[model samples]
Target: MPSEQPDGRGVPSPSQVDVVVGGIKGMLLDGTLGPGQRLPVEADLARALGVSRGPLREGVRALSHLGVLETRQGAGTYVTALDPALLLAPVSFLAELQQPASPALHEVRRLLETEAAALAARHAGPQALAAVQEALDAVAGPGAVDPQVFVEADVRFHRALAQASGNPVLAALVQAFAGPAVRARSRAAVGDEGALARTVQEHRAVLEAVRAGDPDRARRRMGAHLPAVEDPLAGAGEDPDAGPS
Candidate 1:
């Protein structure tokens, strides 16, 4: 069969699925395919890759899941936009799958955010600063807000902070690391009476530092703020010292 890779042992050397995947990836790397470009017909691609339809389809599906391909009904499969944010979505999912109290994820978040805050302090314009303020206002708004609502605003604030850094790559990295942390923070907020208030206070501090155009202060404030968010989740069903399980 075209899908079988014959070895000396008379066994398949590699799965057809992998062959298809690797072939497409090679096409991508060599510029035979490109972002937003339509791929050849499925049959054509299968023949070109020396694989059968089944394995080619499976490989396409897997690449689609990785945000590397897009299938449009009636048109055919095409390369995705391949934006960094879109490509990093799977990394976000992987981060979300980690333990709720994972310190490693928090460490990554801290590293990305601290640098983002520093950049934001240097680069943020009035509109970006306003966006940050709006996010902060949503979280610290009057009356009682739902924990989920607070979490959403909290995420928006940090994302805005990242965007203000004027670096798309840094923003995407921050977003990828923040997804799971936000979920964990939401859960922690539900149980911890003072979590929301403390979050507002911390966000305010970071915003103030960013607004003042003090890069060092902004970096320090963000570094401090992220760990504070993790404090409530420290002992939640996992050993804080142990790595992600």
Candidate 2:
């Protein structure tokens, strides 16, 4: 580690760290490092960048969290293969944690998912369609899987459906919102067997619409599937008394 300067002046500069991380990330973007190639030694890196060890390690840790670098205990750190989706997981977490004060998120999900399901109906290859079916099957049982399990499977279903739409952006967008929202909704719906049954039925309807290649039906079914949960901000909201199924 480089010596810490109390006044925080000079020595291992923060801006210098930024520059080094940016350079390395650029190399990652350009495929210069190539996946699995061992990074140069820490001493080698400091020498190459003309910086002290402190900032160099900090930059490496930051990149590691970004999923652009992998560190092995005895071996060496290396550039990751840089899968775009893997790198975006933190982005998804941030998106999910954004303001939930309004039902705007439900609206967003409704808009994206309607279009995604419709496109999936038309463009889904056989394999993608099968993946959707598998997810549907996993969640088909009468009882909701543990809230966490159900949320995860629900994400897989939506993500697979979004992928079937043939749009990576759509998939990523859906992945971002669905995880947090599913966790919330599943928790709200747990032990509410009626709601669980209704959810399953709605999913089945969406699946059928997709299977029939009827985009209009798919879109409508998706829209109908959005439940009006207890949103105090938006009216008294739909009565909890209403049976879910």
Candidate 3:
């Protein structure tokens, strides 16, 4: 291992791991490394980055977790496709940690989903529209209405709406925000027939606007739906006194 030293100009360098990370990132941005391209062999890359193998390996691992890189068995590390959905994967896991629900999460959904509904109205194709309809049907389906059915259908309805928005990143964001609030959402919906009925009616309105391809109406319907949806979560247990963080 080379001794960690100043750049010989009196300025201390960043940590070796950071050096490796930055070096790889620079290469990526400058087109030296590209999607699906395997990185140079470890020994060569280590020398080129002025870092030891340990830092290089750690950097690769970090990048992999970020969806910036992938390791192939017996092949080597390579850059990933850099898809928005892939890169945003961590947001879903982090959102899960919110648990019982956070008012802030719901607020974010309100904002994003209103715009997403508008976008869906503008861009949804037949197949996408059908998927949304299926989710809604599942919600308002048959004789026995399971509370869990509402929760799952609710999640799917929003997800399908987002996907129909024709923005992968926006869809991913909406899905992430929705996941963490499920527990509280279900808590309030279960055994509440009125809540169930209200939810079905609201979803139908949003779907109607979206199906009609009216962006403005879709946006308004979604804006209206989000608040009604979150009404239960507040009482379900996310600290109403604490306010939205």
Residue-level error in angstroms, candidate 2, position 178: 0.6
Tens-digit per-residue lDDT, 53-152, candidate 1: 9989999999998899999999999999888898888788888788764878888888899999999999999999999999999968778888778888
Compose the digit string of candidate 3's lDDT tens values, residues 96-205: 77765577777787888989999999999999999999988996865777767777888898899899999999998888887656446656778676667666777787
Q: After superposition, how far is residue 94 of candidate 3 from its true place, in Å?
A: 2.9
Candidate 2, residues 72-95: lDDT per residue as tens digits? 999989888767677778867775
Q: How big is the RMSD of model 3?
A: 5.4
Which window of ten consecutive residues has the lowest lDDT sum in model 1?
236-245
Q: RMSD per prediction, one decimal?
A: 5.8, 6.1, 5.4
State every prediction's TM-score relative to the real structure.
0.81, 0.72, 0.85
Worst 10 residues of 2 by lDDT: 232-241
Clashes of 2: 0
- Largest TM-score belongs to which candidate? 3
Q: Which regions of candidate 3 fall more than 4 Å away from where they truly are?
A: 1-12, 233-245
lDDT of each structure? 0.84, 0.73, 0.80
lDDT of 2 at 164: 90
Q: Rank the candidates by lDDT, best first.
A: 1, 3, 2
Q: Which prediction has the highest lDDT against the true structure?
A: 1
